[model samples]
Target: MNIALSNTSDKPIYQQLFERISAQILKGELENGYCLPPIRQAAQELSISVITVKKAWEELERCGLIHTITGKGCFVAELSSDRKLQIRDEMISKQMLLDTSYYKSFGLTLDDVIAMLKKVY
Candidate 1:
């Protein structure tokens, strides 16, 4: 339910919203069945477009992180600890694939990337 959007980030606004919300849900910061603000309300509060909020919500549902009920609003899905860890690993693996590809294009080895990541992380 808490989010801080970065206008200068390379990622789109909707993507930023989706990532933040999903991370919270997976980390149990947002409990199972917790109601998310309506798309229009969230858009207004975040000063973003309604369409952006809608897209992020749609992504959450698509990823099985949340579900929507007609007239009831979207709620976080019930996830066990194992399921949360699985989803976290899956998401991280996917992102790492892309990052590895990017690093490879720059001729950076795994050790080089790890060193750089350590510095930033």
Candidate 2:
């Protein structure tokens, strides 16, 4: 599992971790049963607190993207293609809602947003 952490980001470290891992799982980049490093090890490697990595792992488990087995480790959850698509859409929809609200606050209409998105995308 690969992740990049940004100290300057507005989001908390754990949130950044959770989002990146979720995206990878949803994209099938992390296959089912993929083992995740222990929280302490991940924290040491990332130079972050173990608590941060633990929180992110907990979030992933809460989202049904991973499962933890006592004495073993955490692993990516097996999901059908349709389920993956569903989760991906749900995640994107949540982010889009926030983005749309931000654009609306800037007085950007749907067309303006779409045009900008087209260019950037």
| CA lDDT, every model vs. true structure | 0.93, 0.94
* Candidate 2 accuracy as lDDT: 0.94
What TM-scores do the predictions have?
A: 0.90, 0.96
Candidate 1: list runs displaced more than 4 Å.
none
Model 2 lDDT per residue over 12-100, tens place: 99999999999999988999999999999999999999999999999999889999999999999999989889888988999899989
lDDT of 1 by residue, 1-121 (tens): 7899999999999999999999999889999999999999999999999999999999999988999999999999988889889988998898899889999999999899999999999
Question: Number of clashing pairs, model 1?
Answer: 0
Q: Cα RMSD to native, each candidate?
A: 1.5, 0.8
The worst-scoring run of ten residues by lDDT in candidate 2 lies at 83-92
